[model samples]
Target: MSNLNKLDFTALEVSGRNYLKWVQDVKLHLTAKNLRPAIEEATDKPVGEAEKATAMIFIRRHIHDALQTEYLAEEDPRALWVALADRFDHQKDIFLPEARHDWQHLRFQDFKSVNEYNSEVCRIRSLLKFCNETLTEEDLLEKTYSTFSASNIVLQQQYRAQKFTKFSDLISVLLLAEKQNQLLMKNHQARPTGATDYDDGTRAMTGGSRNAFVELPACVIMVGIWVKDMTDGRKLDVMSLVSEDQHED
Candidate 1:
């Protein structure tokens, strides 16, 4: 046999357990014998050959794109936006042929667990579909709004403030929170780093023309006020409520 065809099946280091599990999962999703063929065919050649690499890349992209649909079901525009931001800012690294400074290079620490990362991959793709929608569908053309109860203000605030500049950062924060919680669980209850009560009042006005008033934390309030002061037209009309009773009056 030629040198190219002389590859040994015994030496090709495929994980038997993982390979079996992966095959089972594929069979569950797709009736085709994708895993069996993939494995059987691979036995005749080297794993990282050019054709195999290309195929692997294609499969990874398809899987990553499919996972991003989760945020759509939530119907939270901001959440969807965050999901896209997460993919662009975090998860694209593994699939991208080259790394760019502008594009986020996702790190291991950015995810709490592999499961969370996998979930986010799906979420980001779903959000991309939202982004690609027409202006009307995006709420720029036609909007919707919902009012929250007085008790929910605290929750609204916390949710808005915790949203990072990029969805990736937000995911990183969550992962960090989860990791810290785990540490706390292991040791006696000790607070984690960068863990703060991010209670700031702001809810998604949805499709409303009324700009969502996000009353940021004490640290961000001054920055918000400064930005508001500089704006000429109607600015983000955010007000601080010192106490719960203040809403009653």
Candidate 2:
């Protein structure tokens, strides 16, 4: 009875297959203890006193409020189990379509991380499986790609080009790609403009060019304002000023 208390049971309600699964779990536990006869219809022989007591204990502990009032008066555990099944089994039909819609439309949102997104996908997959509608590996892969962030262009492209038989492999690649993206973003933010390495392995700006720009701290902003004033007041083209400056240099 102490061990039975530890066994998890989903509360029974008007809707969902969770109650059916919970009942099945309880039945298995009873079967393992050689006490299944307590909850099963008695044959030619009468049920033992111990079996009846065990079954009653189980029902009293696990039965939900929605079902308690109706089944509480019943002395036979097997009859009570059957009554609950007859009333709630039809709920699978109602839950199936809803689960299908939810699984089909499930997408990774910006606020969720990769693991969080994967957990939701797995959760919906489980619901679909319970409804006898399991998605194929290819279908799951496609759905995963479809829901992935549009910003993950490189990862998306790599996924398309690669040949991955297992969804786990794809997830591994995606996690690695996400980490690499984070690292690139961090490096980009930390690096100073003109300090970034060029294709030739040299800094973007030479030492002299860097010094010239640094010396004229407000030059770029001042030039932009001057150009706007000249353009509005004197009808001067911005390109002419640029060409004049280039020639002077």
Candidate 3:
């Protein structure tokens, strides 16, 4: 008996937009059970009773109602799979233009972390590939570099000086830089104020001379702007601001 428990097709149904990926998942599960040939092969050759039964059960249990009504009546799992693919696969055609628009306009915002920004780039790339559009590594690298926030000047300069054949390597280096910058910022935040005892046994208070302007994190600044905009320029309480930042994070 095949371990059908290992595959849960319910999670694979993510609407028409993800139909291709869902079909791929179904095929992989079928292959694992030694039943893929029943649906994938063009031969009219009969499969074992067990294989045929298993395929039918899997398909009926997993497919969405919209797909099942149209395809399941065929009673042949292979035909049903093909019919579903033919119907829902046109989603890429419908979505390609919107995806392209998003890619062209996408940029790293001050409020987003390096990881978050990188993930969005990867997502756009995947969507484009699903629509039968391919972007080379060079294209990806250029897109990633061009989308960085204006605050990331040091990183932009460092990356520009080096050549990376792969986007992953560039992401790794950027993530490391981001981590180091975060540590430095934390240290700066924790540094002591300027009050010290001199050798003449006099205490000197240099608080007045110390810089009072503390640079806020980009995310915090963005949150403040958002709150102000949403409330029509009304200021929020400190706790409310803190809560909003927590939610955003």
Candidate 4:
């Protein structure tokens, strides 16, 4: 790392189970510190003794305590790099086949949610990449479309019609659609049967110099009642009133 005083990632494990990832992290940190050349097999320019010591110290700082003692006498970072590689490079063979299997079986429709499906996709893709296998964007999109539930064939076709160039863009649309569906379901459950709409009338003023009498036509007034649930055995209540108005001459 640029600042060697701080550790950017976990130190290499003594068992070497994390060797591949640790190797990658080491290379990145060494590169950031401009000490990569000291550990490289072939370098266009010469590496100074002081630079080698610096690279050695950086590598030692990122290794397990047991490893530090195991390679305590090692002076050159390049030699230590080769020694570590020889000891743990077989991990590639150990993990590649499983990564391939996981990649082959990953599917979008198999997951309950888009997030879960996406997580699996990413995990498989990362493992494949670490094994030196490339999982292209087209492959990702096709995998999702082909694995769609049988009932969603039409929906899958609609998404394919969008001709998405990036997997992220397509997944974003899928996630948004999922959230909207959930909201609609929640609203439906909140009110199983819909409610009625009400329209209100406006008030007006009409008069002769001295207020006279007026007889309005018989009118119908509508009052709506809210019905919570029909299956709950609650009684519905409604009322209607009729009255006559008298005016003086």
Candidate 5:
């Protein structure tokens, strides 16, 4: 009843959880209308109706994908945009309400039996947890892939390839390399005061400072020239003196 913004985040973690619960409640209410049809399609003994269960699976995937995209970017717009666009086949509007509606209307009609329905429900329940919803961690683990995201997998690769003198340096490197580069750009302002101390110290010790990863992407050729200057004695020789003077006369 009181203003939620007035509450301290450290002491009052309930608001965030409540808000997500509210959203999920609304989504479930809207989607429940379609569940019977979906179950019917998935459970039907006839092959014609049974094939329709695939549609239900697709719908569930869409719902999960939408929630993950929405929640991931809710705090970081840039990352949200990047994740929604890249992860969902370049679809720019993953958060649209229409998507939620379409998912709600999806139907499945054929499954072998109650066991199959239970099995599918188990899978769906795990996926729902991975999205921003009400589910236990144990429930999530039941899924074949508990945590699935293309960006994360790629970042893992980048993290593996990086070589840093310090652990933080490697983190910075991996942050920039990930396709969801936006994730790194968010919550940056909330970083602890000492988080950058190592980087700053390194820069000062070297007498030069540059965020090589962020900068190189902006002007790669210029970076090459800068590197050349640094490596070649910090000098650029246009022509030396002029062997041309002797030849011109």
Candidate 6:
């Protein structure tokens, strides 16, 4: 790729199928490059000619060849931005309803992981935002709370009891719990099975008991925090620890 093509985001296509995302990417990059004023209607201070020229070049580089040729006569970054918006801004009209449908059906329990759920929610939220629909923190929280799978009633109740006011706080807590649970699982897998601890800190394999498994009761809390039976949503207690002991002939 040419050095110009080595940009953070790909050039906007002529079809404008990805117009919404492309606009967002361009705005973010422009802000980062301190060229935002080049396209803005008003600025705290006058945007220098050199800055406007740089912004014009940047905007041109991130557009399709057809678009470049279409607006070759446009020298002003602000004018180019307005032209692009006017040409492809109709994408929101086509995407808003679809975004709403996805948002209405979004379920936290439907996803296998928190990260996936978070990503989907953010994507839909961005689309809604583009359509002038605001998704509040309360909306995010309610959507998450209401979508807990039937098997996770107890877990859902536990999270509700905490009364998380912000989506960020709730997601942060869930991510931490998941990380801790994964670490505990890694430690458990690394430990040898059928090895019991003695009073003097010695470990020995039980005789003729290959199926015997030791429970780290202290660490089970990590499992209880995140993992729940999809069958019953039952909070498995320390006393109800699951054993994966292997059987040997």
TM-score of every model versus the real structure: 0.22, 0.59, 0.67, 0.70, 0.16, 0.70
- Give lDDT tens digits, candidate 2, residues 71-91: 668877778777777877776
Q: Please, what are the lDDT tens digits per residue for candidate 1 over residues 1-249?
A: 122243221111121212222323433432242322322333554444443444333233322233424432533322332444444443333323222221133333355573555365444434333334222222211111112235556643564565334444444554676688788787544445333333233212222221233333333323245224465664453333222223553
| Model 3 spans > 4 angstroms off | 1-15, 44-46, 69-72, 191-249
* Candidate 6 local distance difference test against the native: 0.81
- Report the Cα lDDT for residue 14, model 5: 23
lDDT, each prediction: 0.35, 0.66, 0.68, 0.78, 0.36, 0.81
User: Candidate 2 overall Cα lDDT vs. reference?
Assistant: 0.66
Clashing residue pairs for model 6: 151-233
Clashes of 1: 9
Residue-wise C-alpha lDDT for candidate 5, range 79-100, written one tens digit per residue: 3323333444322132333334
Error of 4 at 198 (Å): 10
When summed lDDT is taken over every stretch of 10 residues in candidate 3, the lowest stretch is 197-206
The residue-by-residue lDDT of candidate 3 on 1-249, one tens digit each, is 133455575433436666766777778888898888778766777688688878888876676555556554687777776767777788888878987998888876532577987788788888888898987899878877776678877777778779999988888987898899999898667644332223122111212322211243222222123335465878665445544554665
RMSD of 2: 12.7
Local error of candidate 3 at residue 77 (angstroms): 0.9
The alpha-carbon lDDT assigned to residue 210 of candidate 2 equals 37
Greater-TM-score candidate between 1 and 3: 3
Per-residue C-alpha lDDT of model 6 across residues 92-120, encoded as one tens digit per residue: 89999999999999999889889999999
Candidate 2 ranges with C-alpha deviation above 4 Å: 1-7, 14-21, 24-49, 109-111, 176-249
Q: Lowest-scoring 10 consecutive residues by lDDT in candidate 1?
A: 139-148
